[model samples]
Target: MISFSPTEEQQMIVSMAKQFASGEMRKIYRQCDENGAIPEGVIDTAWKMGLTSSSIPEEYGGPGGEHSAITGSLIAEELAWGDLSMAMHILCPALFAYPILEMGTESQRKKYLPLFSDEKYKAATSGLIEPRFGFDPYSLSTTARLDGNEYVLNGEKCYVPLAAEADLLLVYAAEDGTSHAFIVERDTKGLEIGEREKNMGIRALTTYELSLKNCHVPKENLLGDPRGYDFNRIMNCSRVALSAMAVGVAKAAMEYSRDYAKERVAFGEPIGSRQTVAFMLAEMAIEIDATRLMTWEAAWKLDRKEEATKEASLVKTYADDMVLMVTDRGVQILGGHGYVREHPVELWLRNGRGFATFDGMAIV
Candidate 1:
């Protein structure tokens, strides 16, 4: 009993974003990859478009509506079609905003939500995953202890996106042998950022190691339960973004493969005329349709107050893998061109890899 039709307002927002992303975001996407710096201007346009600030509260001077997933998913797919790396960079503040919106105190929300609205201030990196811990949020080598109303944290968090440039950090640590999330601002005395890890794709967003040496944080910065505070809203907003990203990437790859198969002559006729090539595109079509539906279903469930954790994981798992399949076939259809940087299938392949293991892919 759910509907995915866009309201007039939502449709207008999507159209406007599509226009802006096509015109402005596309131009900078390749430049960012070439220069190895995800510029602020690309994301500034997204913020002006209200893409990242949609998670903040409307009362806090943000769009902040509860039903942002549809619009967000729409934009994510489109942006990924333009450039996956730049789309991810534009969403940096968004990833941090989820934890705050779900777990922040009024003061914390007031303090950080405005940062997203500013279009200039980038937020912090999330220190959730560890080299040893992986996605198992409960198991941990990191330790945080309360001493005289100040929390002393000691840990090393790795693969943290945007760690080099993050202004604040949300570190997950164990206190009294129980896991807790700590809010550590940038420039803290004991916190040190490591070199950026060179990812296979999505280089526009940086990942690095964070060494927290006796990092002391105020008691008030604690977000939710050390062990119990999971932003377990099943319509998990982060994965929602990822699902849309996959759909966008897959859509583009599918189009490329289909077009290439049609024009590339093989055995006197177009390869697309061949049963094998046409079937490949056909399979891609089916998977893309399914992926889009799953994403829409999860987003739709999220826009309502419904149980969507299962649906979200399903979408994440299916779309995460589907994008890879579509893109790989896209490369196959293109033969040699797919392997080269001239085509974006390689980047799509790289982008799809990160998402494959996220959102409980191992468990699923």
Candidate 2:
């Protein structure tokens, strides 16, 4: 018995998110992309929406509410619909806070959770993707070795969002052939912050390369209990979130192209009336719907505390293909206009290309 409808509360959040996306994010996305930075005002405005605060318990100095992956997925889709890079920037804190809330020790939660729940938006991020070809999360190039009561970390992490000003970083590495997340403070010795990466897409989001040279942290910094937290679960949440983002980006491209095709006339006929254009739009719509359903299903399973490894992987793989296909079709439909910088279809296509490596950019 599976229900695909959103709850009342979920609907409300989705509506609010959609408004924010359409009004604020869409208005400034291009400028930010060209500038290679999201304005602080834009981020602060989203923060006031209580995206992070509402999830924390009242006991932890937040407006009490449950953290639902389905709701998060809904919200994420709308936000990314406005702009992918800004959406990632707005949600970066979750990359650090959600993992702690999900599997951190009681003390860890008490220490770190409140930071996110505070009145102002806090900069916190995660480091997972390493600088190497054929990177795998399960088989990390980064290594963590226990020495006495502390763990020593040795690795280079790339594409870490908000790394320049992030107060806290949840660095993932392999220890005894198992993935583990370590909470490292920004000022920790031997942890060097590299220059901001000039990425192919999502350029508005500030990402950096990091060099960890014999960095050490107390055993308490390890997330979860002695048995260790479920790394797979975290990865699943990340996949679902990324899948939702792909849906948003694809949806935006589809709608824009659809509208363009209807209005643009060639030889006194709307291009959309032609069979080839109509069929391509139809296929794009079908692919987007299929991918959205898969993403929502994975998010639903995650909210119920069920294993969603397969579903998450399925949606991620499907979305990886769907977004590229849809955006490419959008560019094709728009002809010369799509290739120009004034139009967003090319930008969407560029952002959509990074779906293959979007592992730790988001979490739910």
Candidate 3:
């Protein structure tokens, strides 16, 4: 099984995230769910705790975290156990932050990095997908044409989380039929944001439609690779984090089911006394164990700087499905209580349905 036993530093981070999440973030979870609003300070506390910057390097005044794929996953799992949306929001900056730190020019980093920590600026999102299709970025329809010192971008992107609240967009656009990435500030000419999408799951995260009507971006905003940018690598690096979130949701389901079974009465006694009920819990344990092993293997491969695309793909796909089974069973064990809006299990199931959607985890 994938071992989650953390090292001294890893354990310390886990404990810190666990403590804070159980306290502050836990209280606000349902509030955000009910109101579909994430408080402004949600990301601040994570940043202050250094958990949000766990993937960033020290050169950028960050925690100097070594890009260990497993470590970040561990952190994500812990934070997500309390609330998935909050966990995602805390780590969302990495989507944009990573590309800049890895590929941005000194001038680019100096200008954009400072905005991340500044509450006045809010956050920036990585806009890579298009309305044309999902998962495959190669199907991009956006065009970026060089015009003197700047590039003019025209295209629309959809389903990007944080697009509504982003101050800048790290968008992927085509340059002479070659894929290139552009960092378009929100105020850029002809840049427009459509209405927030009404999604069934992860409602706290507001997805948006980005319209760039011949938008003009400065020359310096481009990152590395003049040719088409590689979305596979970006998605691969993010796989571990996604698995960790699933782990968190699964862990929550397991614990909730166990406790509910123990207390819930049945025909003869508490449901926990039933052999059939015990068997279901046993199955959950098995899936969780297998998924953990796979997730860690993928993370270790990434830490060793090896190609983990297949391993990550395998884990993300199975883990998402496993969480659905586990959570659905949790609801079954809860009987009427699980289906009611008063319980969190129903919400967990709704949120879980999409975990397998993004990044092409479905039947791929």
User: What's the TM-score of each model vs. the native?
Assistant: 0.88, 0.98, 0.89
Indicate which candidate wins on lDDT. Answer: 2
* lDDT of every predicted structure (CA atoms): 0.73, 0.91, 0.74
lDDT tens string, model 2, 1-364?
A: 7687898998899999999999999999999989998889989999999986788877767787889888888988999999999888889999999988888999998999888887688999999999999999999989999999999999999999999889999999999988999999999898999999998899898999999999989989998995548899999999999999999999999999999999999989999999999999999999999999999999889999999999999999999999999999899999999999899999999999999887975468
- Model 2 alpha-carbon miss at residue 322, Å: 0.2
In terms of lDDT, the poorest run of 10 residues in model 1 is 355-364
Please list all clashing residue pairs in model 2, or write none if there are none: none
Candidate 1 colliding pairs: 179-226, 180-226
Ranking by TM-score: 2, 3, 1
Return the clash pairs for model 3, or none.
2-293, 58-64, 179-228
Candidate 3 matches the true fold with a TM-score of: 0.89
